[model samples]
Target: MLIMANNFFKPVGSKIFIINFYTFSKIENLIVWVNRSRYKNLDKIKYPAKAVIIDFSKCKPNIKPYHITPLACIIHEYQSKGYVIKLKNIPNNIECYLSSFNFQQFTENGSMIDIPVSSDCKILPLWLIKRNTYNLYPNRAKEYFENNHFDGLSLWPLSISLAELMNNIFDHSDSPIPGYTFTQYNATQDSIITCVCDFGVGIPVKVNNYLQTNNRGKLTNTGALLKAFEMNFSTKSQPHNKGYGLDNIISNIKLLNSKALIISNNVVYRIFPDNIEYTSELTVNFPGSLFVIWLNVNNLSVKEEEFADEAPL
Candidate 1:
């Protein structure tokens, strides 16, 4: 079966493909076509299917992290859905790589993916955890820092980001820890990545609900996400509250020359170094939100400090 490139690259798709992933309707299973020579175009495979068919017949040279990360994420998505995945027309080089990777479903016995995560990427061990209160998260995430070997300076912004994320889950999401959080540092790439995923009310719904309660006009998912980065913008109504949480995350990214990708509903928003920005609305929607944070660790200049009082939230 031929999947047309034009089918995937709409206006929003050309800029940000993740938006298109959620918009694909009634996607019970996703069939992925990978052109090994054009590996960078994996973003075209935007939605999740009950089963994923990876036609890697064209791939000859083998794959790298850029390929691995998306492939792994897709594999994880499929496994989480208890779906069957098959890779066909693969070359010997790719097969050997998958063997060495110990990737499940590709092995001789069709086992599970067992790539040396600690080596390919620094990862958080806590894949799944529950949370009703805010206090437990940071403590539970201590393992993430310790295992990933993060420095105080690098940990600072992450600490604040996680807190606000937890608080958001508490205040608005009305959903606890039905989320997946991955924190990893790639030594060779000189970058640190933290991706947290949640299944909840999603950003658009939460934002519109608040607006409706306040008798304001309705805002689309794109507007709500754009507002999220604004300083003091919030949905919470509380005493002496200043919603600087999202703004704080944005600031730290600027201070450290980092990048951020925020996805909710059908919208995808990204902030890159030098203040580059990209936003797109999807046809489909992810229930809650996902935050992918990328920081240049070597360029970091934040001074390490001892917390005299407590955590940043």
Candidate 2:
């Protein structure tokens, strides 16, 4: 039986859990802390506990989407497992921001109240894409990009990257839950941050499983992740599935001098324009996967003809 630590969370009687700000101040802490809270005092709390309160009163005034998206993802994950989630002391603006994401759809009853969309809003609202309705993402995303002044060439890579990540949830992650995504564009920097997250069997597990089933041996979590980036590396058995998706993402990032952060299993991989870095030393393993990519909007210059490359000599 795991005990609820004083720093990360506080168990309120037998039903409610209070998650303090320290637990989610950083991405790493959020990922690990939530996992810890998930299994704590399982026997003490009744099935479908009353609520889990996230105390955000101590947070700063300005909260970005990156800060909220992962929190929302974890909250949704908990909700799926029968926990009622509630917010405590959320700043008015933060509450409004959450409303713009239409987070009311995930919460039951009046846990989250909706606020009208602000006229000056710049964010492309968060989307919940189910496997059966995954096809809707690209069209909506394209419209978002276009409305934000993203050129056709820029749309090529951005759309493909977003679509590919979404596709992986169904074709690779094998998750039953719906996927979540949202984009934040920085007009001054001419950059965009897109987050795609899902509750699924992570990449490493899927990759190693495929390898072991074929008697090809298993890989370390880090090794499996590295293998996932290589061209033609796929868990799929079909010959037509060449696994070009991740490879295209890597190439597009490099070409645009962009960056990406991928967290799956117990590992986090950082992809930069010049190099990639990864770490497997996570305090708690992620149950699924999250991808956050930063794209330099002005740097997208790939024409249709530039997409094809000649075979290496």
Candidate maximizing TM-score: 2
- Give the range where candidate 1 is weakest over 10 consecutive residues by summed lDDT: 22-31
- Candidate 2: segments with Cα more than 4 A from true spot: 1-6, 21-27, 37-48, 81-84, 104-121, 151-153, 237-243, 275-280, 302-313
CA RMSD for every model? 9.8, 6.3
Measured with C-alpha atoms, the lDDT of residue 228 in candidate 2 is 84
Give lDDT tens digits, candidate 1, residues 266-295: 787889988788998765555567677887
Alpha carbon lDDT at 254, candidate 1? 81
Clashes of each: 12, 0
* Candidate 2 residue-wise lDDT, 110-225, digit = tens: 22322212223457666666645566666666666666575455466777887778777777888756667777777887887888887688999999999999899899998888
lDDT of each: 0.55, 0.68
The CA lDDT at 154 in model 2 is: 43
True lDDT of residue 190, candidate 2: 81
Q: How close is candidate 1 to the true structure, as a TM-score?
A: 0.58
Displacement of residue 68 (Cα, Å) in model 1 is 10
